[model samples]
Target chain A: MEEWLRGLRGMILESLARHGLPFPVGRDVCTGWAEGLGLARGGRRILYTSCMYQLYPYVKSVTGLLESLGVHRGGLRARMAARGGSLARFLARPSGRDVERSKAILRSIVSLLRRGGVEVGYLYEEEPYSGALLYELGLEDDFARHAGMVVEALAGRGVEEVVTVDPHTHHVLTRVYPNYVEVPFKVRSWLELAKPTHANRRVKVAVHDSCLYARFLGMYHAYRGLLDAVGIERVEDPYVTGKDTSMCCGGPIEAVAPDLSRSVAELRLRRLSALSRTIVVVCPICLANLSRAAVDVEVLDLAEVLG
Target chain B: MSWAEAFQRASENAIPRTGMVLEAYRYVVSWARELRKVKEEVIRDLDRYVEEAMSSLRAVGAKPYLARGAEEAREIVGDIVGKGKLVVMSKSMTAAEVGLRQHLEGLGNEVWETDLGELLIQLAGDQPSHIIAPALHMTREDVARLLRERLGADVPDDADHATLASVAARFLRDKFLRADVGITGANALAADSGALVVVENEGNARLTMTLPRVHIAIVGMEKIVPTFQHAVMQAAVQAAYAGLFPPTYMSITAGPSSTSDIERKRVSPAQGPGELHVVLLDNGRSRAARDKELWEALLCVRCGRCAFHCPTYMAAGPRFGAAPYAGPVGVMWAAVTRGVEGAGNASLLCLHSGGCREVCPMDIDIPRIIQRVKSRYVGRLLRTG
Candidate 1:
């Protein structure tokens, strides 16, 4: 497990330094996708960024690396958590395919912001990883150093304000970064930015707030405000759905213990399953973990179902 | 073994109980803020409060004993109660720390846990999974099975909660009457009037503290409040946090039962215990007092609400708790009193949801405390693993 994590960490760090990309995002997938926006190098006034913005392909790269180490999808946690080896589960960890879906989510949010009359610019290939995983893993030194590097990269690109795609990135850049490093950029989750001008979608979705967004960031209301304006029908489950009462998606423990992560996710999924057939989420981490756990239900990103 | 099964059962019980507590918080304006202020003041001057409590209780003809640690605490209790005396005790985390029941039983004294949950777990030979609701891990069927084996009773496999309680009560009522000594844990120790205030929904604590010829109330030194009014307020907040409406029974036991009704003569022995012994156990609390960051942990009223709301605890039950203490608060208590290793991997399971901290009446910042415990392990092991 240690060797696997170490190798994964090295791969991510190497990709960030060499490619000038925070995540191991797919080069081919992002190339044509980047053409419409026509991303420029200098974005001084407003820069819409995300720590895990390139999450879909980055997750894919992680899965590929793990497979190379003889740990395939579904088999990843089994080999590591093979005590009784009775339980079987889907791999909810971020993968390259998840990065593709994440890209779509980001694209919709960017488009929504554009329609909201905000001229948002992207710092393509310049944005660095926010070291959220490092902080969560209790690697304070690495996190502090990585935070400084990320801040430096953003500052070097002359970016002042950051509109984040997901709460994990939003939380890290805004809250965690200032704790250790000097963060000069103004930050907000894109949900906090995008105006709900589009007509009602008329869809019923059960919203699951990831721990960071709901509790720490206090952005649960922001999502609700958007959903309400978008005219989506919200099916509230008093048992499992609410502001602080909602359960965690268990994505954070994926690095430490995948089986435990699966257990946590499964527990949360059961509560959510009773609520709605379609579960909508704001955080990419939540989308990945809950989507994998939703065997009998469909999980949608907030962006996927929104304006 | 089944995290989902336990999570479902525990949450089903916890959700409504939590609502009651939240409503209490809502009605009692600034409950958390006011309590935090009072608790902070009391905990900072814990030594003075401890001294004041001892001096005042002593004046009331109750002998107050101080023990440095768990070993000393057990020895002190043993000395007072003596050998071959029936001892009936309520659920007290302080007593559990030193394995008091086992120590007394080793010396040939019969010790019975009077609290229903504690009694069930005791019969089953199990440690408490939750501090407030100790037998939370055991289902009704499990309790029935344990009772049948332990007490040779006609307990059916599918006995209802009322039936189970009746059996436990019938068994404990005799012990309460026959016992020579009654022991309890105080929620708060008021220094001004030297009152040991313990609040409980079950009548067991009241029975355990009052019925016997001798009463020994054991509490951590951190339980002390400044005055009677402060004790009253503390009880209110503690009850609200514990999902009770200021508790069904609030036992404010100042000293041995006294009577001045006979021509103002101040005769000591009344209906209650003739002799009273208040054991204020330090047991690493002073060390916690000196530490700046860890000091607020001592302010915990042990309401057990934090555990109920905690996801890891809900899923895993006892697996999420430290020994002698359960849930997020338990993690802190076990770390401070016992050490970091006892907290073990359970502290790491905390997802930093901040749910526990939000509902915490004292507002102890439990997730951060868990992080601190995790850091200690990380520092020692040189890895997050």
Candidate 2:
């Protein structure tokens, strides 16, 4: 998935340059304690928050690629238990190593962003994160304590925006966090941020609407409209579950129903094929699933299409 | 016929129990939100674009009249139509918004929709659900069935694609040759050159304008652009939005299809129409143009992209709204042109996705406009309450 995502990101960057649109690249930071212990220096952690993590091979591949790209492995599990539901408590078992690992990963991600010249911010007060585990471990205030240090560090560097793909992250930073951080922010999908620099010379394509975009974010048509403006002929995908009626990409259900997930992906690909030979997807999970399905069509991210 | 009577008849024919009205309202709200997000730079220069379009139309030897209302537009069209057997057309939702077809037909002339989709709709005895792709909801099987019923036993169910194409081709070819006049909607009209841009996959529009001796192009006043380049850009955007390969073909008719190729002295014997007429219908466009927020609805290129992406449209199919216009843009257009009471209620189900805005080449924020319409509807309800 990361291989594909990286390819998509590269395409978007190229397209943006071609179209004379703005493209900003930078680093981000998250400061939170796992279990009751703070993260030690030089520790490793695994981060799994996005629904995309449920897809095993794809997640493994993306994580491996990110690691190869110099990303640190920590125990930071960024997993969402349900759609807009609570974070998993099982991962919060008072194992000091687990906590330390999670923190290390978060720190590494932050460092990566900083190195890339991007600023970081945090909004970490929702769901189980604000519930009993941190409190039970008697380290409830550790998140705020560490977050303050990171925020201060970021402020001193004049970093303005904390770019995040998750709406929860955006909601926390913008609305929940009490830091009164006045930094202007951008909450967008990786595809939106990394649009290609080249004009789409190819005219015919179909967009497979992502559930996150259509259902949670209400952005089903915006992508289509943007593609249209960029001179790409958009064909209608009959199986698109738009907005409230959106169908899940089966990323979430993959843990319990892998076959069902694959079937859904196949069904979606078939519908998309009816529309066009080129299928442009917006979500990381959808890209992974459809790519794995081996559908005999060119699969691209919307940003890639723009390129 | 008065617009009031026409509207009454449309209301009677409307599938009142269907969910179209609610779905259309929802689309308006969604599109309105998107229009609001358009960059200020684009919104600020709208007047200039309008002026440019008006000038181009005048330059091409086409008259650009700004009618204040439907009644005024009726008088203008009535004057042009005269008593000489009113051969009518199928081109715009604006015509449907104002009920021009029935009115002209009532004035006692044979009216026909020459475009294959419009003709199919005419034969099916249905109203257009989308501004473009009017028959998008119908499958080939439905068309085959309808054709079989209309053409009788001679039409075969197992007929190949070529045979079916030849059938409709043969039927419309005769209609085109014999029609006294042809009417069409301008995708974009250059205000500076008075050139009319007609984009279509089929050659119906070309035949419609050229075959008839008297040619008429009807367009909303807002369809005007300042220059040919701007019109071309808009056309490209429309084609992209409509999901076609730059539209199967685009026809730019300046005056009529007259050519000097027939003679060395630059004289045409029988090529193109002798008289070309352009009707710049205002209907309720002027009213919409006055409101800064709702005015951008006039910028629609009638590409049908918004409807194509609309969730409600996908679920309810084309019959989801009132005649002439359907989907999100249609709801607002219907309201403005048809009346708030008559069409405002049609767009109650729109989800505020801001998708329509993102796709709009002109970047019209449709969701915001729909909200404004909803507010007006709410205010009216309050007043009555």
Candidate 3:
């Protein structure tokens, strides 16, 4: 490991330990999205966002600021940047519009589940970050500790089934967490749980599959099924949207290599835009990263598109 | 060309070819599954297979030597070829693994890479950028310039692909005619029949081995399978998954050419190479096989499909891994051949997209292996720092 990535991992573990999140953002940002959704709290089944959807806007701002300031190359500057916690809190804050958009997408997911007769609750502040970044970054020890805390938090809330909203969160809960800890909850993606009535809009859109959802989690068909039920005609190319060949938004490398991440996202956006002006994504990371690169095309969440 | 520019060109040209392979042979998926099982069976007891293969080769009059590591393998080969011999080589990643070509050249031997892509890479004084297409990073324009500059072959600055190939062909035909030793990497070595299988698109490998009086094959221990049928299956599966299905040619050589044509009695040096030598290189492969999850990497057939599908690989070109080995599978190979530290921080470049595992014919869990490497790398960093 290089000094920069090592320093970044150190800083992230500290943040996760101190603030219960990867950033210094408070619990309000994690639970604020469910304000008027009228969902129950402390129930057996809850909609677990894993703070991915809420934190993505902040991720966008922070990665942009770090990239522009040339903090990607680690040393004194990067270590200094990581230690400037207060400044990060200010810079990591999402805009008012971005906050509302995040809330709106979550609200749409709840509504779709409700319409499909699948009533779900919200964990609010009790929901823990899935510790996906910890696992993905290869901090297995830290991830194991964090996953233990998350499982404890969910169990305290009497949560037995977690309906996840994004691919990264859904994947950690469904596949990765159990290996590190005793996961007591049943993990399900909203794509599998939601069955909203046909919209009959008959609109054509390009779908950007989440690498986790499409390949690792076996949810590719489920996502396409959601689009079909909503009456959206998917315009796909074998190279662009092939089940095996779909491109990534490069979210996984954003923290370590921002410039390369942006270039990859731009490339993916270009291929997707050629298929349709409206590009739909199933993961929050994809939505954030792709939305950053989207100029002429409209990048929307599958939840937003479904609503 | 820069890494980014090369990535763009390679992806533009490579993606469609893979798509065509996938569409043309839907049976490739089932074939890959069968190959995976066979590879798993062989890797389960690699040492046993090595002993079986060595004895079988000896029985067929082909000398087989198992070199414990890279230095030993290089030394053995150096002693065999001696100094001032002419050696022409077919494209072999295993040869690149032990740095054979440079070693032979270092010993005052004339060495030429017969594969067109490798020949270009050799002429350019560059390392191979891809496993199958060694000079994939170079465009036709780059090839024209290299031929014009290094070989001083008469070629237009804007020569087409065929013209560039012909110039290389005419240049290499002479080397093939006069070469004393032909060296190659085996695709699969059969322990049951003492056969060496090679899958190729061009006829260069066939000529390289047959025309020379001395033939030496450098093989990795992992290329061994139990039977001749398994070896052939391995070749077909590798070719199909590599998007070069029904590979234009496949050569299965069991031993040095001999004939009982004269009064039903065998005679040596009948045709082809009078002597065949097999050098099996371990070089940390057996050590790698002992690892819990990393042992899965030994089953890889080097299809190179994983590189085309990996975003970081497409963006960084050869920068993603050590030379000759690049992309996701390259990370594993580098970690094996070159220690964990030698693999560098390139493991950080993996996105954990899980795309490589999906495309892998061997069903190796590359993402898990990469995570393990990252974990180990970080652990080493934490301890040493």
Candidate 4:
């Protein structure tokens, strides 16, 4: 799990850097995701949502899993098979409908296990679509029906629990859906779910509390605790805090109020000067914002905190 | 008003030959660029972190309320202040952002600003020029004369910070004890448990919130966080950003001061307020939230670190921008929260160092946001041409 998390962090960092974002400390990223996912227990079967770019490094692991499944496929085929049945075909087809169908398949798998009395631990759902599919479709009355379909499918497959890493999904499942109320839900970040065991030496760290974390979400301290445990002695930068009091970090607002973005960044840098010379950020867009700042401090993802 | 009209008005009203307007813009851009370089990875993990934060806030038993505009915020504040008197308030830029204090005072409540900086500004009959350091532009001589003029002879000439502080403390102590109501701003609000976090160096905020019979906390709707743990981290980030090792004090308020220690009943402490009312103000934030470029400005945690790090701000000596928010963020905030007319010209001075971004906990791309706003100003110039 740690290895996969490291790889994932590296992939994200590389992508962000390519886009001119700040670099992140690996361990901070790992701990944040670990805590978010509630995976600190040390024993759990964690399944990752895969894209070809993300699953590339796990080729050997996928190949082994596929071989165990009696499939002699190599490379890409093996990787696809390991994700589950029919995922490869969907990926190859590449259409909006295909994306929808793929989500349905995953949901079906979750429901099937729940029904089979398998006592599934958690389901990490992503964004835009979850149990709130009915709401999105403007069929609010069918919410119960759609929710039941998901629940029964997970239960039928012997999966007893479901969790979502996306707050929007969690909000819909826990707050919006009726059938989902019975299911124990833990909504968190991928970093919180994958805590790193190693710590970085002589490193300065800065944490960017995502707007959702500071304004909408409220898991600010958990992210801090995770960074502290990873041997990151300093955490700086505070312009984002509380519920609605936090700054937007120039994501959706990039198209309109670009000057406000600079102002927000300037505000954040003033806060960071007190913590450490290096910044260890937890969020991706923050990294992007900091990267454009072009300061002297070293910026790293939380995942890079550990060896 | 349109960004162009506001910019023109502000530029025209600005103190000539200061160059603060252009310098502020350059500094913000430079600071933002520096922050971007350091927090690259965090930008990628933004979506995940936001999810975690929102979930935690909900778990703590807080309700999410969206405000569409300034009118909505006024309504929320109106509900909380209904027929109240002898109100004592701690300094909060959020209140200033929506002009809550003036609005309340206009309603005839006799509001007293308890923070020394705020009080000094009130005495001087001027608006706050900075967020944290409200009277940053004033010198000891200026304060001494002002105090002497208002409070009379006993006030010393050459009064130092400590002496001035004591004088302010002595004057406000009675008000703290006698005030019927208290108003304050939150550093962070945990949504999961409904915890309001306030960080301060002075004990005034503590006294203000606890001493009054009815305590009112006016926070922006975006101040919500998911949990206490996240609030702690965010506070640390705020302190660091502001160049403080740790904020001198931290207060986590869940609700009204209550104790179940009494016999078969709850008893409130003598010092703590009995009733707590929270007023969540939206005031231009919903539009900011939806605005791709400007929304990032809403993520500011109010640490005031950006102003401290800004070279132009330091050189300009605090008269750099409009009241309540006086740095790079202040310039932009003035444009968005206030009309662009009076304070928006400060953005023209920013140098775009990206240093401010390096220290931001949320890593908002301040320079880019500033550029976007400026581009609009430029666009207006062309439209008129």
Candidate 5:
């Protein structure tokens, strides 16, 4: 492990343990998207954001801050930033514009689910971070403990089935959580539960397959099926969207190596822009990372396009 | 080239390769499963397999030597070749592992890597970016320049790939004829029959192993299989997943070549090399097999397909892993051969997207194992800190 990664790990673990989120952001940033959506407080089945989509904008901002600070180079400065050297101020808030953009995507997801005739409850501020980052960083012990906390929070709220919005949260809840913690709730992606009616408009978009959805959670067909059902024509290219060949959005390493992450995103974006000007993404991280690198292309969430 | 340019070129090269792999993937997947089982069984009792293989090699009249470390392996080959010998070598990760070429050269022997890509990298004095395609990072222009400068071959400024290949081929053909010794790596070693199987797309391996009077093979212990039939299956499975099914050539050598046609009686030292030496290089492989989290990595057949599909590998070129091992699987192999700390930074390049495991023929849980490697590295760091 590098010095900065160790420092960042310590900071993130402390934040998650203390505040139940990876950052020091407030509850409003998490539940604000559901403010006027008329979603119920809790139910047997619920829409679980896991705050990934909401938290990502903040993650994007902080990573940019870290990159600008040359934290990727790693040294005493990294340890100082980890100890809250103007970092807390950056992590304290995401830009209102970015927040609104993320909120609109979350809104689009809720609208799509509603149009699909699925009424679901939202946990709002009670929703816990999925600890997917912990799992990704090889912090299994911390992730296991965090998974227990997340499971307990959902179970206590009578949440029987989790309707996940993003692939990372979906995969962690469905495939990874069971290995670490005893889970009483059934987990499913909103893509599986939402049965949206056919769209009247025709559109062409390049669909970017999320690595987790395509390779791990097996939602490649489901998302493509949804696109087809909505009368959207996906510009297919093996190098861009092939199940085995599609590139990652580089979000996985954004925090540790933002420059490399941007490079990967640019590579993926180049493949996508060659096919279509409008790019559709299934994962929030993909949406964020690719959107950063996209110059002329419009990166939209699958829900934003479907709805 | 810049990382972006390198990444784009790699993607351009790998895209079609993956397409071809997908075409044969469904058919070869079952063979991959059985191959993994065979590898697991062999590694489980690797010591017994080593002894059995050595005995079988002796029975077949091939000298067998076990090297406990890289230094020992290099010294064993060095002593055999002596000084002032001309050597032709096929592309072998094991040979790279033990630094055999450098060591042999240090002993005052002339060595040439016969594979076109390996040769280009050797001329450039650069490490291999991808195992199968050593010079994947280099452009045709780059090769033309290297060949023109290093070999003084006649290559046009805008020479095509075929032109470039033929020029190198013509140059190496002379070296092959005059070579005093040939060194190669075995894809799989059959303990039952003492057969060494080498799979390749070019006929260079055949020439490198057969044209010389002394033939020496260096193989990692994890490459051992139970029988000759199993060894052939292993080669086929490796080639199939690498998107080259029905490989161009698979040479299965049980021992030194001999003729009995002279007097209806067995005769030694015939058309091929009169002597064959098999060096079984351990070099941390046996210890890796005993590691609970990492042993599955030994199941890798060195197909290099994972690098094709790995995002970081494609993006960073040789930067993603230790030399001679690249991509997701490379980090684990680096951990096995170079220790966990050596693999620490490289392992971090992995995105844990599960792409490598998804495409792996042996179905090795690459991400899980890398995480384990990462966790161990982190643990060691924290303890020391």
Candidate 6:
């Protein structure tokens, strides 16, 4: 194994050690607020963050780990490819207003579900990653072990259902988790959980479908359903949208081969930015990566638009 | 060329064609299930079907041979079609797999690739980029340049395709008549009836199969189906996936064209070829078919839609394939037929988008297949190192 990939793996394992997570525990402050709300936990829904939005705060650590291992940086694309593997994409740390924006979106989702007469609770810092990276990178044995631990943890909470914020997590929990071990709890994308409430924001938005959500979860129309309910005008790239042909956000492999990821992101954003200045992204990784790559476009979480 | 650059170049030609195929595939959505069942049955019991096909073809006076691997298949082809003869070939991905064209040419036969795309690729001294449209990576400008220099045929630098095709057609038609042998790869072979089915849009396959004195079909062992009806249905799957309702022509060869109409006597030298030989090439397929999941790839009808819809394949084109195979199924095919390293490397090109599965008529679950292959290959490499 390459020295850097091994080192990056060590760093991820360290995350699990320090915070019972696979990413840097960069202060999940929203979980504290959710805990204080004392929302009924036994009431059918457990709000799961997938730790992606929290990982947003620590994503640079993977790159920092890469440079520390002497993997030289170049341009954005070349530098990404220099990292040698996909271990780094675990962090899609949101920045600026996006952090506060991301937290607000999560808070709004809980409130929206609450308004709809549903109960929501958090595992706080105890939430583990859905082990999506391990599964995706072909570390199935590791993922299987991790998934067992996760199922045990979630099950111990007496959790009846899971409200996942990210598509990768939603897919792993819904689709992948069952194959390894029994997932007794029902997993739903937060988009499925949150009913629309007026944000008083009336602007055109392009819907950038999460490949995991739209293609894997068969949620192509589900987002449109959510968007439609929000009473917002949403635009879709005709060629790249729909159930069969939705384009990827290029965030999945950002750490494995940065250049390829960049090129994919550039092409996708170029096409998307042509349609609308503000695009509604479905996953935090999608929001982080696309907003980073956007030239003159605003990338927002779907919940952010609704909130 | 770099894989990314190649895909960018090829997609200009591929994307529109894929759009058309996706549209056509919607109409035949029902066939995918039927074809999947047929592929499962035929592939799971492939060896038994091969034996049945061998017996059935032999009974009809057509010689059949089961080759263990690529070398044996190439040697069999070599022995049958000897030196100092002109050979014309139809478009065949299997032929590409064993390097048949290069092997035949090395054996002193003047082989004229008859398919228009194959002919252009042959003239250009380039590798075939697509299963059906072999020269899809080449622009008209590239084709014109190659024709002008290699074929020495007068074609303008910016001349459109039709004119360039006509010049090549005139040159190839003469070779077609004089060729001593013709060769093709079967889309599917009917084990029960001893029939060889070849589907193509061009008229080349029909002429190649019938015109020569000796006709040879080099087919993968897995192409065997239980019945003629099954073979035709598989052909429909292939055509539909290629974005065609059906090819312009379908040629079903039932032994050599023999006639008993003349005075109650069946002639030895029939209307078609006096000699008909079917080479069932295993070429690691027997080993692959034993693999519980990898074998599903052998049941693939080579629709090209999986590759067509793949984002990596769209970005990388033929470069996305390892050997003769490309795209998602290509990764599996390459891993089994070629070697693990290239296939493992090519596997990374895929984004795990699941777009191919959505379009796959068979619902092959290609992401899982690629991942499995990658896991095995990486394990082997680490152990060896």
Of the candidates numbered 2 and 5, which has the greater DockQ value? 5
What are the lDDT scores of the predictions, listed in order?
0.73, 0.52, 0.84, 0.51, 0.84, 0.74
Interface RMSD of each: 2.3, 17.0, 1.4, 16.1, 1.7, 2.5
TM-score of only chain B in every candidate structure: 0.95, 0.79, 0.97, 0.78, 0.96, 0.93
Deviation in Å, model 1, residue A60 alpha carbon? 8.6
Model 2: what TM-score? Answer: 0.53
Looking at model 1, residue A184 earns an lDDT score of 88
* Candidates' chain A TM-scores: 0.81, 0.45, 0.95, 0.43, 0.95, 0.84
Could you tell me which residue pairs clash in candidate 6?
A: A56-A93, B7-B316, B21-B243
lDDT string, candidate 5, A22-129, tens digits: 776666778888878999999998999988888878887787787777777887667777676478788866677778878988888788788778889988777889
Where does candidate 5 chain B have its weakest 10-residue lDDT segment? B10-19
TM-score per model over all chains: 0.89, 0.53, 0.96, 0.47, 0.95, 0.89
Residue A266 miss distance in model 4 (angstroms): 23
**Which candidate gets the maximum TM-score versus the true structure?**
3
DockQ of candidate 1 is: 0.40
Ranking by lDDT: 5, 3, 6, 1, 2, 4
Going through the candidates in order, their DockQ values are: 0.40, 0.02, 0.59, 0.01, 0.53, 0.35
Worst-scoring 10-residue span by lDDT in model 4 chain B:
B10-19
The regions of model 1 sitting more than 4 angstroms off are A1-35, A45-53, A56-97, A199-201, B1-3, B21-32, B383-385
- Predicted chain B of candidate 6, TM-score versus the true chain B: 0.93
Model 3, backbone clash pairs (residues 3+ apart or across chains), number: 0
lDDT of 3 by residue, A40-103 (tens): 8768888888899988888888777677656666766677766756436656567777778888
Among the numbered candidates, top DockQ falls to 3
What residue runs in model 2 are displaced by over 4 Å at the alpha carbon?
A1-307, B1-59, B83-90, B158-161, B256-270, B319-321, B339-343
Q: Give the DockQ-based CAPRI class for model 6.
A: acceptable
What docking tier does model 1 reach?
Answer: acceptable
Residue A38 in model 1: lDDT: 54
The docking category that best describes candidate 2 is: incorrect
Compare candidates 1 and 6 on DockQ and give the better one: 1
